[model samples]
Target: MTKISTFQVEDANTQIVDWLKIYAENAKVNGFVIGISGGVDSAVTSTLCAQTGLQVLCVEMPIHQAESHVTRGREHIDQLKIRYTNVNSIQADLTSVFDTFKSVVPHTSDILKVNLALANTRARLRMTTLYYFAGIQGLLVAGTGNKVEDFGVGFYTKYGDGGVDVSPIADLMKSEVFLLGKYLKVPESILTAAPTDGLFGDDRTDEDQLGASYDELEWAMLQDESKKSVEDFSGREKIVFEIYKRLNFVNRHKMIAIPVCKIKK
Candidate 1:
C-alpha cells in the first residue's frame, strides 16, 4: 500500500483558520455553526473554526446515536469550550423526531432501499436542524466532510451532509485530517475511535460501508491522479483501486454542481 503524504501541521492550521475568518467576515456572517460528530473530520473542522476566534457553535443532533459517538462529541465540545472563548454548544435529541418521521411516511416493499433512505433521512434531519440554528444565530453552517469522502468516494448523502455554506476541511484527505486532529490536540477518544457516520443508529463504520479503509482510498485517489489503472495493480491493490473507481463513478454527480436544462429559442 502507498503511504499517504503529510504536510507541515502548523502552516495548514494557520492557513485554514485565516481563510475561515476572511470568508465569514466577507459574507457578513457572525460565525460558524457545525454539527459535531465524534469523528475526526468534525472535530478538526470545529477546532479550526474555533481558532478563528469567531462564534463557533458546536451542535449535537442525535437520532438514536451510538453511545460512543455521543460521548466523544460531547467530549470534544467540552474541550473546545475550555480552550476557546468563542465556542458554545447545545444538543438536540432527535430520536423522537425521527420516530415520528418514520410514522408519517408510507412504507415500501423495498427493504434495502427503505433502510438506505431512512439513513439518509437522519442526515437530512440533522442538516435541517443545523440550518435552523444557523438562521437564529446568524452563523454559516460549516461542513465537516474531508477530501476522501467528499471527492474520492462521494460517501456522504446529497443535500444532507453535502449541504453546507462552506467546507473548511473538504480539501484534506482522511489521513491529513487526522494529522490536524493531532496537532490541534483533539481528544484522544475521538482520535482513537473508528470513523462512523452514526446515521444508521448502529455501529457500522465508514470502512464497513465503503468496503475499503480511508488509508487505502487515499492511496487509490493518488494513483487515480497519476492515471493508473486497475490492470496495473494486483491482489489487494487491484481490489481497492476497483472499489475507488466504482464509488467515484457512481457518486460523480455529488462531486459536481447540479445540471440545468438550457432553453432553445
Candidate 2:
C-alpha cells in the first residue's frame, strides 16, 4: 500500500481556499454553488468554500434518493449553517424525461445501456439544477470529486458531475480529502458516511461499482512502472491492478479534454 500522508491537509486547505477566492473574484462571481449528495466529497468541498466566507449554496436535488441520503444531505447543510435549497423535482422531472425517451425510441432492447443512460441523466439533471441557481446568483458550480475518482478512474459522469466552474479538491487523493475534511471540522456523520453518487436509486456504493476500494485504486494508479511487471506483484495485487487498469481505460475519455480536429491551412 502507498504510504498516505496527513501532512498536506493544512497546506491543501490553504491552497483550495485561496484558489476559490481568486477564481471567484476573477470570474466576478458572487458565490459558489455545489450539489450536496450527502457524500464526504461534497461535505468537505462545501465546508472549504464556506471557510472562505463566501456565499456557498449547497443544493440538494434528490431524485428517487433514499430517505437516509436526503436526511444526511440536509443535516450537513444545517450543521454548517450554509445557505441551501432542496429541489425535490426528482420524480416528476426524471420520470418525464425517461418517459419521453421511451416514447421516442420505443424499441431499445439493451437494458444495461438504457440503465446507464438514465443514471447519467440523473447526474446531468442535478448539474442543471446547480447551474440554475449558479446562473441566477452569479456563482460558480463547485465540483465534489477527489483525485482518484476524478482523474485516476474517471468515475464521474461527463458534463454531469464533471461539469463545474471550479474544482477545489480535484488534485487531492481520496485519503487526503478525508484528512482535509477532518482538518476542516466536517461533521462526523459526513466524514464516516459511505460515498455514493446517488444516481442509482438503490443502495449501491462507489466502491461497489468500481470493484476496488479507493485506496487500492490510488495505489494502483501511483504504482511505478518498475512494479508493472506481473512478477513484481502478488496474485491479489495483480487482480487489483487489472481492475484499476480496466477502469482507467474505460473512463479515460472523461479525464481528457475533447479532441479537436484542425484543418491544415
Give the per-residue lDDT of model 1 (tens digit) for 1-265: 3423345678888889999999999999999999988989999999999999899999999988888998899999999999999999999988999999999999899998999999999999999999999999999999999989999999999999999999998988888888889989999999999899888878899899999999999999999999999999999999999999999999999999799999999
Q: Of the candidates shown, which would achieve the greatest TM-score relative to the real structure? A: 1
Q: Model 2: per-residue lDDT, tens digit, 1-265?
A: 4433556667778888898988888888787888887888998888888877777777877777788887887777787774433211121235465456556864468888887888898888778878888898888899998888888888999999999988899988888887887887777887888877878788998889888888888888887333575456788788778888788889999988899998999
For all candidates in order, the CA lDDT equals 0.93, 0.79
TM per candidate: 0.97, 0.89
Q: Which ten residues in a row have the lowest lDDT in candidate 1?
A: 1-10
Give me the overall lDDT of model 2: 0.79
